[model samples]
Target: MNFKKKLSDILFLDIETIPQKEHWENLSSKEQELFTQKTLYQRKDEITAEDFYERAGIWAEFGKIICISVGFFTGLDENKMFRVKSFFGDDEHKILSDFKDLLESHFSKNQHVLCAHNGKEFDFPFIARRMIIHQIVLPKKLNLFGKKPWEVPHLDTLELWKFGDYKHYTSLKLLTHVLGVPSPKDDIDGSEVAKVYYQENNIERIVTYCEKDTIAVAQILLKMNNEKLLEDKNIIKV
Candidate 1:
């Protein structure tokens, strides 16, 4: 399928999430019981729910977004550049509120679409759920109620790469490597995000990693469009 949308209208993004608390022991007795019941089927008889808590960041109900990095194209043709910005902090509500403001102020148009590696199944829904949890209003792009599937402005690089084959799953690192795009997982991967956030308390590193993933999503789109990748100098961090 041809990508007819203008690159300038696409907002490429990535998010970093960690479990709501540092450890299972941090949860209240009632909360722990609820989590255990929630994960009973998934964990089966192999491990206790507490033992599985480390993987909770993958679920919106048990996780909190710490960083959201976004990138957009500016200019046209050879003069185009990618500008990246990040909203991150220990306060999940503040991080999400800032992101919501950005969407409302700039990317709320019908033509504007948000892109991420696995956004549809992960990032997109995660953000919407967290926003609801925080009682923040869902941005136009993320509020899909009453809208047709086609009307929702969401683009997933992984979905684009699928080409109708739903059985295979591809990671952004592998996709970038195969497409000759720069790899963004040199220093850290998604699995390490929770540990880095909770154990190391390094929000800056997580922000940097999120920004790189955002840029990689944009690069994947350029590759799919047969456009040249942006040079390092063309990526501006804000």
Candidate 2:
């Protein structure tokens, strides 16, 4: 069963991350050894560790979050507007700290919950790990220290689609396409995020892409409840 929350109480979010350094050579000897050892089985025998380093961004320990975009609805029905804002830059610490403040200030309540696509496995844990690494305190919404699985204040669009099949996996792009939510991959996809950040050095483009995914998560939630999809005009980028 889909657990429904008031539209106004849910915060839809997405994050973009990149490898800590631009290239494999940028990592120290010890870090490279650690990376190779940990990823050996996952990379298989043919692909060298350096050749597989492009995937480092998917792991929080080897990567840093560059952007976090969030959207939430205000008002009801035809008057509803989704306000989106992004915290992004080359400074990972500042980005994490700023996101923590936003969570503590606006979304700090038992009634409030966070919703994201595949957030349970990826987005939520990645943010929490980066916050711990930076020595920033976790906000109520993100901190799962003593909370039971049922008590966690989070909603994952991917999890909802699973319907008790633990092995079922789906990408946000695929889910949105099948569920009739407007596709968020009009610009860049997740695989190209690292290249765009390191080679192209485009923070604005990343922020735009991240925000679109966040909006798509929101639209997916609405679709699950048989609500209308949001129009472009109703999506205000703050």
- lDDT per residue (tens digit) for residues 1-238 in model 2: 3445789999999999988988999999999999999899898778999999999998888999999999999999899999999999988999889888888889998899998999999999999999999988889898898999999999999998898898999999999999988999999999999989888988899999999999999998888888889999999999
Predictions in order: lDDT: 0.93, 0.92
Clashing pairs in 1: none
Instruction: List candidate 2 stretches off by more than 4 Å.
Output: 1-3
The lDDT, on a scale of 0 to 1, for candidate 2 is: 0.92
Output the TM-score of candidate 1: 0.97
Which residue pairs of candidate 2 clash?
Answer: none
Model 2: ten consecutive residues of lowest lDDT: 1-10
Candidate 2's TM-score = 0.97
